[model samples]
Target: MTTSPLRRNTLKLSLLTLILMGFVLSGCSGEGESWNGKDISGLMPGLEFELTDGQGRPVTADQFDGKIKLLYFGFTSCPDVCPTTLQKLGQATESLPTEAQDDVLTLFISVDPERDSPERLAAYVDFFGNGIVGLTGKESQLRQLAKRYRTTFGYEEPDENGNYAVSHSSAVYVFDREGKARLLIRPDLGVEEIRQDLIALAKADT
Candidate 1:
């Protein structure tokens, strides 16, 4: 028996999601990976980009190079996953001691520039709280940035009612103070585990 192309793609996506989800679940158990995250250091450290932030200011690597950055790609219209992930991140950092939480930054970059304006991004991200920056840019700029991380995202074809989902990565990419890519935080990671990881990074020597 052979699988149709569409079916094969769907199956592959399902498997990938399950595998990533398992990693998140195991990692959140406190019995799993260390608070430092599953070190991916020195690998794919090419996390650099300049985009317009929600406030209409240029956001560049230099501006954030000395702090730990948690980067996520998603859009505002996502029904569940996007908001949940952002909320989890916010909750994870909210109760940390001021110093620890202050040293870390979360960046939510929209993949749906076609409909996600800076104002829209601001509203979505602000709901989470401070220390989180909402960013969006020209579609070309976004693609280049995503390419650097080997992450893929794009708008799906609209149905008759013009509804569509923007296919995007949900994993959180963590970078150390030195700006080296350190960990890829999965969605299934609990708020506690995520908080500890950020605190660990925040408290480290600058």
Candidate 2:
């Protein structure tokens, strides 16, 4: 049977689409890479920051260049989300193989500097785990970092007790060893799923 011109054109287009899809699938399965969280590679810039650690020392992203870092922003006074997320992260990192445990670090940055002083921040992070580092800075510094990650925080009005709540992003931003953004872990992800993603990213070639 002879094919019409329109039929031939349609067949050619379909073949081209299949070829393109093959390339996409190949890319997805490359190096056996897989992530349970949102893959954000190249969607954001590499980690960069200048803040104070829990020990009252100045710190920058360069200090963590060779470690897989999880960046989270929330206040210490956060009634639920902050503590819950930190506990999950602590458990996840602790579950890693002893030799690989040190390869992961969690940066818990407090958005409420007014209430979370350096000393308080240090104690708060210590409650989570040793691998967790609590960092905070001036409001300006926190603002800039949040903007870099495309997240923000705001304060609610204080009650008669003069206590207020701060609202911020609950997702954890994961960065590879070289500090490039890689995955975004939602608050709803299980600890095991988070652990697997961290292991894969840590084992990936820098």
**Local distance difference test values of all predictions, in order:** 0.78, 0.83
Candidate 2 segments whose C-alpha is farther than 4 A from its true place: 1-32
lDDT (C-alpha) at residue 98 in model 2 = 88
Residue 96 C-alpha lDDT in model 1: 84
lDDT per residue as tens, model 2, 6-105: 4554455455435533433444533446778767676678999999998889999989988999999988898998999999999999998887799999
Candidate 1 per-residue lDDT, tens place, 1-206, comes to 97654455445555655665555556453543366455555456556888999988888876887778889988999999899999988888787887677778889999888888889999889998988999999999998987777665756567798877776777889988777877788767898888887876666644
RMSD, each candidate, Å? 4.6, 13.5
What is candidate 1's CA lDDT for residue 107? 90
TM accuracy, model 1: 0.82
lDDT of 2 at 17: 38
RMSD score of candidate 2 (Å): 13.5
TM-score of each: 0.82, 0.84
- Weakest ten-residue segment in model 2 by summed lDDT: 20-29
